[model samples]
Target chain A: MDDLDLDHESVYDGLLGGDSSQWAFGTDFEDPLAGVDTMIPAGVDGAALAAYCLMLGDDALIYAHRLSEWTSNAPDLEDDIALANIALDLLGQARLLLARAAAADASVVPQMPEGSPVPPEDALAFFRDEHAFRNMGYVEALNGDFAVTIVRLLLFSSHRLALLQRLATSVDPVLSAIAAKGVKEVTYHRDYAGRWFVTLAGGTEESRRRLVAGLRTVWPTYAELSRSTQVETLASEQRFGVDPAVLTEEVDAVVDHVLAMAALERPDLPPSGTGPMGRIGRHTEEMGHLLAEMQVVARAHPLGKW
Target chain B: MTTLAAGRTRAREIAGTVVDPEMPMLTLVDLGVLRDVTESEVGVSVTITPTYSGCPAMATMRDDLVHALSDAGYAEVEVKVSLSPAWSSDWITAEGRRKLRAHGLSAPGPSPTGPVQLSLAPVRRAIDCPRCGSADVRLTSEFGPTACKALYQCNDCLEPFEHVKEI
Candidate 1:
């Protein structure tokens, strides 16, 4: 009936573990994705691709984290599992991207000599400074209404699917393979979110208003996604990346179609010029808070295995 | 090859009953994430690719697999996680689909073939009504309660249903 009752009830139901005496959550020390191999594309600038993939990866990672926060808080039990599974799909993509970026040729490390060695997970978890991160602002923003979260997924997945579809044809085999796998999942995410937008917008008066408000909140951040950049140029030249500018037509078509179907008024938000420049070393305060929670358990007992 | 041969046979049997922690009606083997199982000199190793990176149940699934193996007296088990070859719902077996339908959920449709051709994207394929085996159905919502399914309403059966997407 109360807050603790709802929060702890699931844990107490022996769902997670038997007793409170040794109730340990998450990982103790062993890396779940350890022993996995990552294959960076050959002939491409690993640094540029790593940075670009990190941007996409971080977007999925942060948003997936946010979505998981909705567990048990959703409107129904089935919905809770649904959101959690969607979060998992994104999380899976993020993991692969991060792994690929981190495993780039030692050459991607600016200071590393040709023969120098780097542990993959260390390269992934510890090496990248804040200035090196490339995730767009759309993902790290605080949670809005459920409708808004669905809308955000819809928009982001649309863009990602476009990018992944192009990547599927990359000169690089590994990138092509990863893209092949990713495109399928993003398609589902986009379609699922689109369905929600239609229902909420067409369902009822209150639902329609909330759905519109959710769109406005996420629209401002959407601009940065389409902004042009040299990183995109590097990937495009290598024939291993999708150009942000090229994605515009695709992005616009989908967004316009979804909005009209929902019968929602589009926000006249100005396109953001702030661009990928800020994501390099700068970020919203939210990133720091998120990293703190995520890093704490891992850092606390480094190497302790469950 | 011998250990792998033996391990595969055992794994096929064990995984058949290892139901998805979330869906419960489907097994990880049916989902196709359980790639291989090998009996190493140290122990038996089970290789699995996660359907989602942050899937909370992954830890539970790992523990459950170990428990199931150990209970069967295959001690010294090691679970290896693989990510490169990502999971797709297309990997789900036909039997899995039937199980899902019997459990009152629609099965995944076939994967889209040929180029994506966005304008010609597949829509509203034949979905057997999970409740009454009716063929008449209409999609109520693309987004279902979960990420894997779409909400549909069966016209003949007059029941709303969840249809899994074939990724």
Candidate 2:
């Protein structure tokens, strides 16, 4: 039979045309909320809205970078692709949210050299210093192992999915649209992480031990995620955003169910209030390292275009 | 008739025939991503939506739209990606579903109209095998090679196939 008549043609065949080489990594980047009306609500403070978007956007950006670190390092090819896809999803969300933040308050996006063609979202992502980032402590924490990464993803995606579900109804149409699209992606992220949590927990003794240890290591950071800052609380009050604190119960329920299914005990660890609040542009030392690597190229060549 | 009005109709007809690069069997209209097509004195403008936030196919679709329109004598063509009233699996046309099944990929089931259940477990749903018309299929993986599909194995046919996931 001819190649055209093959029953199981490669999926890559569809991806082959139209300069496929340029399609790698960052080529497909586009403003997800491009055509949507991004008008800020009448009563909402622009700076406050920008700050809130930065908080969420920075979390996704930093976490996506960390996940991308697993590029060719995942245990299996499938997992490598899975983690990369998840990272891309978060990265896409980050691009839209950061662009929204920049649109709200130009000050949040760092200034570049004269005639810099870098987009605001790229500026916010690649130019911001560690202290300027507003991501939660858990996502910035170094990836310990596969189990640790999966546990962090489970908690983070769970909390995010719940929060996005409510944010989908925000008074700000742009935020609401971003959240509406985000809920579907985060749902998958949460489910993927939860399934891995159960599988690792119920696998061999070594895997179970690692999963428990990973959970214990990551549990203390959960408190920081649910902690609503002044801006977040104010935004939620004005119906511009969802309060992260309100999502605690829904997030906990999902985590609890997954842990139960895995036959694992919930770790009763104290909150790690080590660094300044992540909501207010303070992060762990590891975050600085992560940023250094992530921003090196952009900082070196401010006007360079990919 | 005004040139703009005539051009708009022609633009829509041209765009309607542009196939999804990934699912070559389905047109953008069949996949419900092509939201609107309009024409003006300057050029034609087309709006499309992504199947998922990170669907890589959007870039190809945009390029395809531009190429197809430009080749059709439209000097300037703009492809706008929208996310507001987000795309849903329910928007997949009935003809699109039939084409998908014919290609040996199970079509997406009816989307749940109510709020999605926030749970850890995979939401259980019955998926019939596209090859054998059997409901005895089990999901082997939540993800497939593409963002919008899942891997499933049919017990009756003993064949593994991809199923468009209902998002």
Candidate 3:
């Protein structure tokens, strides 16, 4: 009953504690690795594997957040549901990836009570500092128009589809398993966004202009595909990851084909936050703000079960 | 009584009775989401696969499986998820298709195989309406309420129906 404790920022300090979801069993649900093998493939450095997983997880996490924003805001109900469904698919991928990371390197997970219902996936998602996130510039960017979402999603999924396809044969059983499922999901995602990209480009002149502008804004994310980070290189060397170099040709073919069909010109622009920028703990101001909103409730009640 | 015993084993029968949370008309077994049920020395374990990666229903299915088995005189019940060989729409049982049609939702056709090739147009499929059996159904959206379905409007019946889209 700390009435007039106006300086306190913790929401859970109040009489009601917090929402039902903050309780462990509500949305936090069960373990992502319920029955899967948690063993790290031999010879693979656990920490390195964890970092790789975080990169993939963070990309999905941030992009899903951006896509979820379109829920009530899309032009049509079907498009709204379509975007939301795609976001849900990415969110599921993030959950499994984050859980895999926590399983590989326990040191990275935030400490929690024994037998706590709050899953490790939630812990990594909620407790990590903004600088700890490893998502790319494309995923962390603020939403533009609906066309921008389509452009960005198309590029991300095109590259991701290629990468995941390669990862399906990984030596790590868990990563391979996750990738096998992910390939199927991202295929639909790439197709959805690719179709939308074509539609918008061929639609009204205004929509065409918006899509071009959207492409320019998210071009940095696609450009980053040309550079391979150290972890990615190492992981690829170990047979559990794909080098960014290899994805370039296939991704280019897919994107170029889509753009050609739409009669849209490729934006000639410099890549922002190039090389190891986002994945190496460096990010734009957008990421900090996004993490702030996404983690606010969970961070406020770190021990709040749900 | 003796004749009925020729059906599926008790554990599987009970587990299969659990319905899908998103589509209640179809049981887990009918949808082919239920992969396996095996009895070991430890207990009876059930295996299920997700129709979509981000499917929220997977958790419910696992919980339902555990509850169904636990109530069926098995002390220990475990549910496992397998992601390999990814679940396909073609896996839907024949009975599952019958149940779906009976419930007015069009069942999925064959799933696309081979490497994914980008298609610019919205997905085109040869779907017949479950209600009126009309072949002239237009796709309203490639995605529906859940990840596994698509929204369609039958030209003949003029009623909106959901089709479990082929993966």
Candidate 4:
């Protein structure tokens, strides 16, 4: 408020306005596609495309949050940065994909109070109810341990990388554009987790045991990731998305190869459930808790801008 | 130059002067994030691309550009982000590479093209120590202090440095 405060705000104060770039309590949300043409192609199914985007976006957002839980909990500093970096990459993907979904169907965005600084993408992320979230349960399950997280990341990123590689050729420009960017990022994520998979498996006796257990812990929900929900099928039929079912072969080859390197057998655990779980809003009770931590600040400060 | 031509030049000059908040050694022009700047009816429009899908530096980049241009006397300014040609470490200008090395940061190598091979083995990057110029630099971690960088330690010089990762 005073001249001294203005002058002492570091080098930024010398500019036209002092340091508006600073973040408040959380990331400052803006339109991820602010400058790009966001028009949905006429031939594309708006509803299906929106649902598909939300599906992928929700998965990334939730998975990123779970990864963040390992921020200070990783076994080492290097692992900590690696996990958080991967989380940041996915969060970026989520922002753009959610923005794409809102562009396709404004109705998908949840309502917020007046004067809320939250954008469409942020609103979709924070305001939606748990059942309304379209993320698969594979990512929503609580983290078991460092090994469990690495296993989850390996599975999710492998599956997502395959999906994005095909989605890059989608008829929809935005979807294709998003997919192209995501492919490069998820490549690093998959590679990181895959290496860890092999390392942990081949490590000390206790590490090998934990690694095998981690695989078993997540195998029950493996079926959910490969099962194509109705929206995915619709989007694929409309040329706006890729169905998860088609990615099964590609993802399996990668996972199998990694497991072979680790000298570990594939867990023969049965599928947790038969068909379309999370995509239809069916999720574990813990998703509510994840959303509570993620959304509480936004909901509490709908009108608070810093 | 004509009035409009002069204005265009002036607008671009102001934009070119702004540096990245995180990596201040390189101007936005040096960094490929600044896509283009053009004069428009209302004012001038600037377009940029994000280095990564979830780069936190984007907000600062936009805010800095707006402040710099406004201070330079642009009446109206608009900043836009494009995602079509996703940013690559290869986009860093030649001068930007020099700046990065001069500041003890390893510049990224040529980006990978075509299908990205999935190797469980660590990525083998043939990099030299920025400080010692020794080819014996080894990778410490694939991820680093920021999302855009990776940690490396030079075996010959015994110094740790960050490499601007190739996305």
By TM-score, who's the top model here? Answer: 4
Q: What tens-digit string does per-residue lDDT give for candidate 2 at A42-119?
A: 999999999999989999998999999998998886678778888988887898899999888888889888967688
Model 2, residue A205: C-alpha shift (Å):
2.3
> Which candidate gets the maximum lDDT versus the true structure?
4
lDDT of 2 by residue, B134-167 (tens): 9988877777777787788899989899888787
> Clashing residue pairs, candidate 4?
none
Q: Per-candidate DockQ versus the true complex?
A: 0.36, 0.40, 0.46, 0.63
In model 2 chain A, where is the ten-residue run with the lowest total lDDT?
Answer: A1-10
Question: Which candidate ranks first by DockQ, i.e. highest?
Answer: 4
RMSD of each: 7.5, 6.9, 5.2, 3.6
DockQ of 3: 0.46
- The digit string of per-residue lDDT tens for model 4 on A160-249 reads 999999999999988898899999999999999998999999889999999989999987877777899788888888888998999998
Winner on DockQ between 2 and 4 is: 4
- Cα RMSD, model 4: 3.6
How well is each residue in A88-152 modelled by candidate 3, as lDDT tens digits?
A: 99999999999999999999887866654567889899888878888777688877889888888
TM-score of 4: 0.94
Clash pairs, model 2 backbone = none
lDDT of residue A102 for candidate 2: 89
Off by over 4 Å in 4: A1-19, A22-29
How would you encode candidate 3's per-residue C-alpha lDDT over B56-156 as one tens digit per residue? 88877777777678767778898888877688888899999999999989999998789778877777898899999999999998889999988999999
